[model samples]
Target: MPRDADATKERILAAATAEFATHGYAGGRVERIASQAKSNVRMIYAYYGGKSSLFDATVAEALRRMAENVPPRPDDLAEWAGDVFDHHQRFPDVLRLSMWAQLERPEATAEPSEAYRDKTLAVATADASPLSPVDVLVFVYAIAQAWQLSPAGLTGLEEATDESETVAARRRSVVIAVERMLQKGP
Candidate 1:
């Protein structure tokens, strides 16, 4: 693809990511994505095939970025959990997109990406804990995202005072929880 086409595609992906994260696949509108991207509906169809295809691409790209930004650390699962928590805080849209995919694309959930596969293998090889590798990975991920996915009313307690301090405290809690889980095993 030419440079202009590449840039346009990126813009479309960004717009689509935000749209789908907010509205989910069924409710996401290609027209709005097009408008947000400063491109037209025809281009989105031409570039991504259709709305469904675009949504798939958007979700894939978001996951790819997350894997790149927050690759697993098998040796230090607690720090890894902290990194994941930080990633979610910095890019809340990624978590939203993930949740949207889980709700709307159940079939797609079965296939693990290479990044996830590598992480699982690393975790298994590095840790001799009783917990299965998959379970460890899932547990760490759940703990990392717990704050972000919590009810707004619950989170409001953290945000009631100094935002940075509360967020840092939450992050510390995530790290400590993961550390304890690793130490205790399952």
Candidate 2:
């Protein structure tokens, strides 16, 4: 039986994704990623060059997954916001990976890629508003991820009381906020 190079690469990426999510770029160890993937560190180095390159590939894959799974819905921004929230809730690893990239390698963060641009452009409403559709989407995304990324300011007290309730309340707030913003008509 022959080993599949693509399958091995996919396994490596999946392992690296989990490692990076758990430890960030500075803290994550390629050895651990290789061990977990049941592959060798040399294979990772050969396939990805090094930790930094691996991180970049992981980030790119995460962004691609997000763009594919949570595309914009201009006809119903509120629904889109909900969908984003759901996606984040389900895939917190993506957010964690992104946070690591932003915090550890701020300069590396670049403008939105075309994968995101087309979707954002489609969501742009035709109105003379100060905020662009992308801006609105960013705000809505922030709202949806408030609890996940950082909630000390958003619901520190409520979170202390009941974590589940706090999360539910925040998710509701995200939907309502996006709905109101969309209803404001551009």
Candidate 3:
């Protein structure tokens, strides 16, 4: 589309991301998103076809950003766990969007991300473990996946305490323990 149209689309998606993340799909409204975006409702329909399609586009864009944020190969799994938390650091909204998306649309759970599976399979196969491929796959990925309260992981802890060296050290310790568990035993 034209330059103006493209910019308008981006604005709408940004506004919709915040709206849907907060209120979820059922409660989210197109007019409110349009008002926040500073464009009218027709522009959203013109740019994104409809609200559902716009929501999909917003989610796809968020997922794309998150994929770019993580390590291609998590060689040090504890560090990987740290990195996962680090990836979502400060931006709890991304996690909020993910959780809200899952609750609002259960189908998201079964939607196959072939690229995600392939990256995971590669990591599992590389761990140099005696466990079966499937077992290794589940275990290794699970190590760093952390509690999926949202993409941020363990939202309660982050929200409760202010950032400090002591807290950081404790988080490191916990992640290290989790990583070690994945490494040892079957």
Candidate 4:
């Protein structure tokens, strides 16, 4: 594509990501994405086909970026979990987009991408845990995202004034939990 077209597509994806992350597929608005992207509806349609397609593209792009930015460190699963926690903290929109996708497109979420496959394989090869590789991977991810995904009421740190300290504590907990899980072979 031409430079202008590429820039326009990137803008559309960025706007669509923000829209879908906040509103989900059912509530996301194509017109709003178009307006935020500084592009017209016709161009969005021409580039992405329609609302659903654009949403899918946006989610795919988000996942791709996450995978690229945070590739698993199978040898050091604890630190890997911490990295995952940091990634979610830094890019809360990605987590929101993922939650929206899971809620709105359950069937699509089960399809394993190459990134997942690679992570699973790496875990299986690097660890000697009795638990299955998939289980190990899932547990690490769950622990890493637990604090972020939890309801505000469940997070007892609501009264905390120093957000950085709260985040650091949570991240340390995530790393410790993953390390214990690996050590216990569960």
lDDT of candidates 1 onward, in order: 0.88, 0.79, 0.67, 0.88
Stretches of candidate 2 exceeding 4 Å from the true structure:
107-112, 125-130, 152-156, 159-168
* Per-prediction backbone clash count: 0, 0, 1, 0
Question: What is candidate 3's local distance difference test score?
Answer: 0.67
- TM-score for each of the candidates: 0.93, 0.86, 0.75, 0.93
Q: For residues 1-186, write the lDDT of model 3, one tens digit per residue.
A: 445877888899899989988887788899999999999999999888988777777777776666667644545555655666666554556666776777876554334365467656766657744565455444544544444343554555454655566447545754776566666573
Model 2 compared with the native: what TM-score? Answer: 0.86
Residue-level lDDT for 185 in candidate 4: 30
Give residue 48's lDDT in candidate 3 (0 to 100).
86
Error of 1 at 14 (Å): 0.4
Q: For candidate 3, give the lDDT of residue 138.
A: 48
Model 2: lowest-lDDT 10 consecutive positions: 122-131
The segments of candidate 4 whose C-alpha lies over 4 angstroms from its true place after superposition are 1-3, 107-112, 157-161
Off by over 4 Å in 3: 1-3, 108-112, 128-162
Better of 3 and 4 by lDDT: 4
Q: Which candidate, 2 or 3, would have the higher lDDT against the true structure?
A: 2
**Per-residue lDDT of model 4, residues 6-96, tens digit only:** 9999999999989999999999999999999999999999999999888888888888898899998988989999999999999999989
